[model samples]
Every structure is written in structure tokens, then in C-alpha cells.
Target: MEVGGSPTWSEPNGPPSPDLTSHAELPEKLRPKNIFEIPVWMGEPDRFCGLVVEWNNEPVHVLPFQKGYMIFGRDPAVSNTFVGHPSVSRQHAAIVWSREDRLAYLIDLESENGTYIDDIQIPLNEPVKLLPGHRISFASCFRRYVFIDQYDRVVKELRKSRPTVRVRHILVKHAESGRPSSWRGETITRTRDEARAQIQSYRRQILEKQEDFGRIASEVSDCTSAKRGGDLGPIFPGQNKAAFEEIAFRLNVGEVSEPVETLSGFHIILREG
Candidate 1:
């Protein structure tokens, strides 16, 4: 069975050895049978974020997130979140939470099996920003930890009245857009005409060829949301440019929009909801 990160209560040393003299003074029933019976000490965590672990649709463990960071690994001596698996390293990865930015980042510590976020293996040591409901996996372990943001009250508030729309898009950037740098940090040199043609071709594939929009967006979209199959989840009004939202709001669910030009680039939007 897969094991999730449980707090490392103490050093990796096995349960403390009982003194012979103390054992002699104790009653027979009180005498220790084995080290396995010894209890591991647990204390209240201080200044931890409200990170909850759920099992079978019920909250099972409540892990407090510290301000700086927390480690995940096999060796309890070095890791804050301990996964007792052979494939996991002693110091596997870390989750660094930033209070000011209200964001958490996952950093792989040059592990043997690597760390993954939503099935995507992250680069070693380079911090990848995490969003709420993102699934994290260490090594080849089957257990996945879902990153929960306790500070999503604003999103909950917005959902009350102003409903949001989910969308997937593919962007074809050109040098004429003035900002040709893609989300992947690559420079786009295509002209406006070239970009327009590329976007139209993608639309045709989705409309006529019945190709998967998400797969196409993940393969070619210039936006960071490409990592999430070009999903820009729950876009609220004013969160995106006027030109982009104009076509986005007008389309019915499951409808694909024609090439829409924005300041960033030419885009083909797929209304998901």
C-alpha cells in the first residue's frame, strides 16, 4: 500500500532503550515487551498553514505548513514529511510557502526518482509555483499529496454571485506583438501573418479534424497554462484582456472560437464551461 507523508516525530534511531534498573523497579505488567510497543512523541505544530490530508473522502491528517519550507523524504532524520519507501531519497523535495505572494513552490532536491506535479516531473532544484488542488508525488510512490490553499476565501466569495468560466486556448505569438517572449522563455520571431495562419490551422484541426483541443494546446500553446493542457481555470471578469474576454464570454460551452487577436498574440479559444 502507498504511504503519504507522516510527520517524523524524532530521529531515525529506533525507540529508546529502556534502563534495566528502571525495569526491575517497575511491576511485571509495566515492564516493556519490545521497542515496537514504545510510543512516538507527537506535539502541536507551531505557525503551520492549514494543510489537510484526506483519505477516502475524509480528512485524516492535518499538516501545518511552516512559513519557510518543509521537506519530504524517506529518512525521518532529515525530512519533515516522511515517506518510508525504498525508492524515495533521504531528502527528496521541499515545498516552500511564501506568505507575501500567497503561493507555494515545489522544489526537487536532486532525487533519484524525481518529484512530479500533476504527472509532470519538475526540474531539480528549480522551484515550480504550485496552485491549489495540485497533486504532488514523490519518487514512484502511488500516494499523491494534493496542495490545498487555505487562503482561497476570495475565490469562494466570487463564486457566490459572479460565476466564472473555464477555457482552454492556444496562442501563436509574433514579433509584431511587441512582447514575443513565450511563457517557456523562448523568443517568438514569427510575423503577424504567420501567427494568424498557425492559429487558424489549429482551429481547423479542432473543428473539422475533430482533434483534441487540450492535446494541441499543450503541445503548441505559448501560454503557461499550456502545462495544464492550456486550461485557464475559472476566469473572472477583468482578469484577462478585453479582447480575449469578448470572444470567451460570447462562445457557448464546448464551442471553439475563431482566431482572436490580443496584445500578447493570436489565440484560438475553446470554451470549456
Candidate 2:
């Protein structure tokens, strides 16, 4: 099945499942009451924006708001995004974009603990104008939500239809690596050139000698993923280091990469998706 714009094959030899679509109708009471309260699903030009959950000023999760209402709380049934904190309400808050003002607003749903913007609680059901960089929180929760006005929306739009890749890699860590410990709990002592040579040799084994890539990766790769045959899972855009992502995203499915250097070490990647 096509989930989140990607096809899923349930069986190893079976055809990919059919794409799924949402056909449920929105209830009238949930619809906007006035022209100024227009939802994003109504389809207006230039209305893409989002929120990012941050920790220590760095983004940890992205909450994209591109539809009617971006509801967030502990309840999956009512919330578009789920925040699993004990203090959070069932339906805590929502962010709504207005075409009339070309702006977004945060509305608290009379939550038990209350929704906070910049550490101050907002009035229940009132729309508070949101600005980029404003920190948001749920019921005095530890997680801080930072608002980004544009947030690379243009680049994301350009690549929205681009397919993401799943990859496995063999890493060779050198003495100078950011983390010089191997998956087997051994400290690395090889030089940078030595690591590069080792990675290149592994690539040669897969391409020329037709050696099993996963077996080699499981045996010698320095990454913790080596335990699972170096599987790094599906790589979405902006999910990994720039150097590694660049090489991984460019290779065709089933293709193996040359030695690619990153802060962690040298890697030989095999694209699987």
C-alpha cells in the first residue's frame, strides 16, 4: 500500500499494494464559520508553513501544518499530531492559517494544563498570532515548539514528489573519527587513509568479487547498525549528514556506492529503495 506517498510490498515476491485515499467527509460543526477562518485545505495559493519541536534550540521533530487544522495532543483520534506527555490534554491546541490575514494563529482548546506560547499561557479558544521563532509548549511540558515562517518550504516543495531511499552501509572508522568506537565495542585505531582504503576494498568485494554486502557489513562495519547488516532504514530528505545523503540519494536502487567520507568515518552504501 502507498502510505505517506510511498509504496509498500507486503510480501517479498508479491506486487506492491494499491494506493490508499481518504474519503471521509468533514462534519459541518467542525468547518470554519467565517471567511477569515478559512482552513488551508480549501486550497489557496502560497499558504504552506509549519512547526518544529525543538530541544536545546535544535529541531527534533517537524510538525507540518498544511491542512484544515493542525491539532496536537495525546489523543490520536482527535489530534493530527500526537504528543504523548502525561500532562497534555486529550485535545490540547491547534494551529490554523488564515488567508484573509496571510498569517497563522494558535488556539488553545481549553486544555486542562493550558497551552503556552513563550512560557505564558494563552486564553482558552482565543487565536493568538504566531510569529517565527516563537516557542510553544503544552501544559508546561519540557518540549519546546519553535515556529518557522518559511522553513525551507520552497526546497521542500521542489522535492515533494522526489522518492526517498532506503540504504545499508559499511562504515570504517578511523582514529580521528568523531566517535572512534566500533559496534563490537572495540576502539578504532586506523588512520583516515587506512579507513578509506578498507571501505574501498569492501566496495570492490561487492562489485567485482560478488561478495555478499550484508554479510561483510555485519562482520566489519563500525556503525551500530552493523548488527542489522548495516541497515540505516529509509532516508528522507534532510534526515542525514550532507556528505552521506548526497551520495546515497544519487545512487539507483540496488546500486552500491564508492567510499564516501563523513564526520563518522568512510562508508560504502548500498541503495535498496
Which candidate's TM-score is highest? Answer: 2
Model 1 quality (TM-score): 0.42
What 10-residue stretch in candidate 1 is worst by lDDT? Answer: 34-43
Taking the tens digit of each residue's C-alpha lDDT, what string does model 2 give over 1-273? Answer: 011222222112333222111212546575322212323222222555677777677777676665645666654444545566668775678777544334567888778899998898988766677887899899956778888876356447636865678999999999877457776889889999999988888898899867899999989999888899989998765546567888998999999998888757899999998
Q: Which lDDT values do the candidates have, in the order given? A: 0.68, 0.70
Summarize candidate 1's per-residue lDDT along 1-273 as a digit string, tens digits.
Answer: 011234542223332233311345777787533211101111222233544554444555656665356677765434556665568776788776533234566778788899998889988865577777887778877666777764466445646757678998998889866256788888788889999999999899889867789999998999888999899988865456567878888999999998998756899998988
After superposing candidate 2, which stretches have Cα over 4 Å from the reference?
1-162
Residue 132 of model 2, lDDT score: 78
